[model samples]
Target: MLEIITSSALPVRHGFFTRKGGASSGVFAGLNCGTGSSDQTEIVAINRARVAEAMGVDAGALAAVHQVHSADVVTVVGPTADRPRADALVTAAPGVALSVLTADCQPVLLADPQARVIGAAHAGWRGALDGVLEATLDAMEAAGARRDRIRAVIGPSISQPAYEVGQEFFDAFLAEDRDNHRFFTHSPAGRYLFDLPSYGLHRLRSAGVGHAEWTGHCTYRDSERFFSYRRTTHAGEADYGRLISAIRL
Candidate 1:
């Protein structure tokens, strides 16, 4: 069976799928839905099919983007033959599921049930810093969703304890805003432990979302249930799986 995490805050049908119930094996095992990975194309299709079924949509109705860690947001009305180079998707159309692939990056799902609009975003630190979450909110509002009625939930991602950063990384955040220093703390190894989820929540709240929260699941800490890019690098693995998170109107 698939292990899908959900939040009561969102009135729409949505889930943050874990790395389970897949046909893949080896490094890209367990629901590796990233087509960009070296995982077999057929296996990735099968895994995505399973997710689409779970979301009550045909496999082709499940829409995604070619994520490039930018703040770009696409307003999707239907599935397209070509995946746009974007980091987030929003839709008011029923039966169309917006999804994002992540391994330790924030998989953020947002919805305005009253407006029947939903969005999904892949927010790594770079994307988050570049205003991807805000851009998602903007796109949803453009699709007729209200900022004050939107509720957002961030799925499993690398927690601060597992996300150590060098001085340059810390410097970049400070360059954006000195208040960003609150998102980091000194680590025992003399590096900085960046609080990515907390930063995500801060961005959503600052953008005027009605509600925003993190699921409190750490991808890097739970290897069995999640695929963590940092963990894969730490283990010197050739590649890693990608977890899929989706939301539907």
Candidate 2:
């Protein structure tokens, strides 16, 4: 069975899928749906297909992008001929599922039931700091979504306790806004632990979203279910599995 987390208030069918029902084996175990990984193409396809079925949609209707870590948001009308390079996708059209793949980075799902628009974003620290959440909200607004009516839920992601960063990362955030220092805490090694989920919620609230929350599941700490890039790197693995999150009207 696939462990999918759904937001009750969103008024849409969506899930933050865990690494449960999948075809991939070995280190790339569970539902490793990333085609970009070294995992066999056939296995990745199979995993994605299972996810599509679980979402009650055709595999082709489950659209995602290349996700180049930019603030780009694409509007999905129907299945695109190709998955463009974007960090977020929004749609007013029902039956077309918009998805974002992540390991420790935030997978944010946005929906405004009244406006009948939904969106998904792949928000890492870089993308979040660069305004991907705000960009996603803007795209949803363009597709007839009202910010005040939108409920945004952030899926499983790396929490600050597990996310130790160097001085440069802290400096970069401080350079953006001195008040950003509130999102970081000094660690024993003199590094900073960053609160990515809190930053995400702050951005959503700042964008005027009616509701925003993080599911509070730390990917790095839960190795049995979630596939964390940081954990993989810490364990010296070649690559890590990407967890998929999707939303539909």
Candidate 3:
């Protein structure tokens, strides 16, 4: 059984799928659905098929954008004949699942059950700082969702304890807003530890979201259960798996 975390507040069908119940092996083990990865294309298709089945939708109904770490949010009505290049996706259509892939970076899901609008975002440091979360909310609102009725949930991501940053990286966030310092702490190695999930929640709350929470799973801290880009780099691996999170009305 796949250990899919769900939010009770979300009225629609959604899941923050973990790296379980997959046929992959080696470095791409356990539900590596990233078609962009070096993982065998057949394996990725099979993994995505499993996710589609879990959502009670056909594989073609699972819509995902070509994420490029930007604030761009595309409003998808159904599986497009051509995939668009965007980091976030929003839709009010039923039966179409909005999916996002991530490893360590935050996979943020948003839903306004009352308005029947759903959104999924692939927010890394660059995208988050560029306003991907806020962009998603904006797209949802454009689809007739109310900010006061939307609930946001952030899935497995690199936690501050496992995320070490250099002075330059820290300075970039500081330059954006001095208050961003609250999301970082000094590491023993003199590097800075940044809390990505907390930052996501902060943005969500500041956007006047009805509710926001993080699942509190660290991608880097657990090797058997998740794929982490940083962890793969630390181990000198050629590539890493990408986790998928999806939601549909």
In terms of TM-score, how similar is model 1 to the real structure?
0.99
Worst 10 residues of 3 by lDDT: 76-85
Q: Provide the lDDT at 18 for model 3.
A: 87
Residue 175 in model 3: lDDT? 98
Cα lDDT, all candidates? 0.95, 0.93, 0.92
Residues 67-159, candidate 2: write the lDDT tens digits. 988999999998654789999999999889999999999999999999899999999999999999999999999999899999999999999
Which ten residues in a row are the worst by lDDT in model 2? 77-86
Candidate 3 lDDT, 51-90, residue by residue in tens: 9999999999999989899999999987754568999999
Instruction: Look at candidate 2 and give me any clashing residue pairs.
Output: none
Best by lDDT: 1
- lDDT against true structure, model 3: 0.92
- Collision count for each candidate, in order: 0, 0, 0
TM-score of 2: 0.98
TM-score against native, each model = 0.99, 0.98, 0.98
